[model samples]
Target: MGGKQQHDIRHSDRTPAALGYSMPPEWAPHEATWLAWPHLASDWPGKLDTIRWVYTEIVRKLVPGERIHLMVRNAAEEARARQYLHRAGCPLSRVLFFHHPTNRSWTRDSGPIFVTRSQRPHPRAIVQFHFNGWAKYPNWRRDRQVPEAAARHLGMPLFEAFWNGRPFVLEGGAVDVNGSGSLLTTEECLLHPEIQVRNPGFSRRDYEAALQAHLGVRNVLWLKSGIVGDDTHGHVDDLARFVNRNTIVMVRESNPRDPNYRRLEENWELVPDLRLEDGSRPQVIALPMPAPITFDGYRLPASYANFYIGNAAVLVPTFNDPKDRLALGILGELFPDRPVVGIHAVDLVLGLGTLHCLTQQQPA
Candidate 1:
């Protein structure tokens, strides 16, 4: 592999897209899945114990499909995670633990965005973009180190993403790729100035250019906003996702009185007119939103759209709502080859995210 040689080259001079690398679709075959073990009590507060159990359940479901590479703070944390995994009956042979400390367990935002180039000397590499605690939260210094540590551990070349000669901030959950030159994102997350000022003075056109240069995408479909309770401003993973190159699974709220109803409806309307890279419109599938889940009067982000697609199964976030079964059935039809397993996410969402928010896939 040209991993060492590519590491010597300065990625600051060129973008990953110019180097013939692009982010793959989630449904693609993965070598492993990366996760950070939940350790911070402040993230879950009163629900930490239940949240730990949910994390173990998530590990149990994913281990059967692909290797799970977990990040722990230290040897003690690793031992604790091992005990939990063992009790959960996860296949120990398929799991590996790394001593990488993180402030929070949400790996989707802090983790490296893995890219691939079929003809390159080193087929696999990673894009390390700046992360600023979603531009709202603090205590992210340790979380920011995750990408470089992960790249070193995996022996993959790491490329730093920049805009106007400065590092740019972008989370993996903020954008979804179709692996066919089309990208899906929201204007609320990337373009919202006051909410999450990711890159100062970056406009919509500037973002599109940066995405094309870094992600190798020809078309970008921007939704207006996300659901009501999404604290990351508006992560597209909680609102919409690309199931295939020509299809999208988006969230839709049925009850008109709900706060998310209007925004989701507006986003749903835009999908039919959205064109793909090939100039053909994509097949839009509307996924149901679960009933509002609240703790201390705050609505948690509990959309089924946060499901993670793995090699052996599609891990869905299921709230104990009537719509959970409906969402599973719809996704089951979409991913006929993979088993649709619902991991109860009522406790997981207490941290404001679910399956897709906690895991990052490494393409094979």
Candidate 2:
């Protein structure tokens, strides 16, 4: 299935894959992590102040490992962020601020998707996949300009993704990579026909083609769905993530009565049958789900799988639940090289996401 041609195409043959460029895994060495300052009060309701502290903690944890490229609306907002970071004892030297304005602060969905060229004088480039508020919100025009802004600021080449001559819509949270050719995604996010559909008529093959062309993905392992209360309509980040090239941590719920139990169970069952790009089965480990977090009568998408991997540490979101320790232990064992720290996210999830949802990694 294809849509009507909506834009002019140039450089159609210089796809990232054809040029030997690939999107690296999060665990790969990063030049910096990209974050947008929390400015939208409506996303966190009355919890925006708390969310700013959450951002501070995230910055504090990651700045030790790599530089933080923070985006702010203007000079005033940058000053506000500086004050917060300064109070948190974060080293301002490792934090760089950008004056790019954003409608919302979920950088993982709207920020630049960086790809690397192994055999180049120019080692890095960005693939600008059109992001339209996950196809569920209205004020995303500013967010959509993020990739171009990043490319312009870094003086790197930017490649616009297109499928059937139309701009391809993708959110970085919808897929996870292994730094190899394998990719993890869910049908519920990219292939759904009606509900928050990203591409209007794209099929599995179409997605595979688009991903290969843009991100150098060869093996597309598809999970059936994501957990309950995911407003992004089944982003892969909340259900499963690659802790290493050969291993995946898929979230599981022990309670059968929970709304997320069946959905996560289906994904766990499907993982064993999937293969990586090299035709080897991935080692699947079950990560425990946090107890359902509800605020104002709504279930929040809070899972340990939404952890962010930094160069210095793995920052996992904790919900003040007992299983928080267990989740940290499991991740700690897997990430022996660095400490696996937990960031309190009870108030942060008022915006319906946690750690991984707010940050994007830029490959070194």
Candidate 3:
């Protein structure tokens, strides 16, 4: 085993160690959220400036209690990122920049899977898996090592998984775990034979088993697909999100005429039918989709579900649509303790992702 197993967490009948790699709950704790500054000009087209401001605004909100590790290709870009963060009024102390070159800025997919285990009698923190650009984006050499490299920088054990290491594909954005043994993912992203390109002989069982072994996910609720206009090919983060163990917030499309209408409605139908590892159905909340918006002849995939839960505030991506206030109000209700601030994502969506798409939470 690439990881040393420990048995301790008594959630109900099963221990975390017995589940799989035994990563801790999402709400367990976090030192900070990790993000890689988007430098690939190809990703943002002509809107790089607008997107930088979006990220800077995001850092400003998360800097209250949680730290932010920002990755830049080199010193030149680091200075540029620093200038943007400074101009955006982000707290300098909470944001730390590293020299890691990546093909893209979606760290939530390329970055590490931070897991925690308290049963070791000592501080045990682990990061599993790496990046291969989802078998779609070519030239992922740099993105591949981010997880372990960041882990070494953080001084934690890099528990790289064995057995399942060879040809399995899973992105952090595609799977949302409540950190309580239940996981939510989209078959459109993971099960697509064209995207993940399942090994010839391996069946769905192999994929599920791999998820269980590596991510400590016991109950995987698979929704059929994801939202349209999503370039990553139907990542779950864009459709459904785990607000907590028992509560889930999903994106719903009311317009049956839209392309995403049926897919989202299908997810709505599937949500109520699933059970967690503890054998309990979750309380589901339906968040209506903001009226669809487009920019420069492109339909930017926008979702209220892409909000990032930060230490001080819940950072929401706003499309500047009329529904912005309503989305914020809803989130404010869910997270009563923290202020839900919307960062205008009209520009960020041009890059094909929002707040949570750009950051990965590093467990404390």
Candidate 4:
């Protein structure tokens, strides 16, 4: 850990990668999971109350495996959350509450991205990326403070990522890593020039350099785009994810007329050509997309690829569709170490995200 000014890596060579730190795969053991308690009614519209219970269920499932670092706005909010968790039979002692206010509850996009070093005294550190509500929403000022607060709370060294003297903007959901130096992302999220542009004027090379410096990535696999109605533009977690170092689970839409059919197919075709960090081709498995879910004239991003891998369980979002069982069975085979649990996410997706989007894992 360094002094406040020294932590900013804009003018220094002490990047996380330079110090041997890399973002761990989600399947790795976690000390705890960070979650921002849902309080904003605008995000879930008419389902805010229902969404809190969803949080309780998630906590109940995860607490047996890892601690829950839950952020709440104030004492009242914490008390309300406690009541819900208590009734749900979630162990209260396993949860640690922080009075950290946030505009939204999606921690994957706004929270600190923790990286780890293998053989160091202080192995864990926080790589604080500049978050701007995914560069799509205006009410992200509070969300931006989450990383710094997290770093202080955990007593971990904080490294501020910057490119060309400006803070670099990135979201956790924008990239998925294999913990073996390979990363998966979509061009629509990082390269699209005019649509929800993050770090304007940054090219592929610039992004690659920044990613290598911060996350220790040696290879980047770029997908064409994401499914329809994803507000984050093209988050990769909604389309593809690394189940293991050598396997990637990607979503494929069978319905030819579906809006995501072509986009997913184009990405699926590229998978065979992609290589892992060690120059070996990764095993690609196809995951089915749930039928289009429409609410208030909006088609929510409801792909099964947005599942979260927890230490106790692999939580997959289920939309009460016929494909839910098939998706769970596929994931169950891939993750034999942990139980594959399907989380009811119809109301959760009304906020435009589900399991993986709402949670961020803290590597142990």
| Cα lDDT of model 4 by residue, 24-98, tens digit | 999999999999999999989888999999999999999999999999999999999999999999999999999
TM-score (all chains, Cα) for each model: 0.97, 0.96, 0.90, 0.97
Ranking by TM-score: 4, 1, 2, 3
State in Å the error of residue 296, model 4.
1.5
Pairs that clash in candidate 1: none
Name the lDDT value of residue 361 in candidate 2. Answer: 96
The predicted structure with the larger TM-score, 2 or 4, is 4
Lowest-sum lDDT 10-residue window in model 1:
1-10
| CA error at residue 321 for candidate 1, angstroms | 0.5
- How many clashes does each candidate structure show, in the order listed? 0, 0, 0, 0
Candidate 2 per-residue lDDT, tens place, 279-329, comes to 999999989998998987889899899999999999999999999999999
Assess each prediction's global lDDT (C-alpha) against the native.
0.89, 0.91, 0.76, 0.93
Question: What is candidate 3's lDDT per residue for 1-364, written digit by digit as tens?
Answer: 1223211221123322443445554445678888998787778889887788878888888888699999999999999999998987887888888888888898888887776655543254444454667666777878878876775676555555443435345678888888888888877776676565424344567767867766777788888988888888888888888877888888888788988898888887876688988999898888778888787677779998898887778888888788888888887888887788989987788888888889888777
lDDT of 1 at 77: 90
Between candidates 1 and 2, the one scoring higher on lDDT is 2
* Model 1 RMSD, rounded to 1 decimal: 1.4
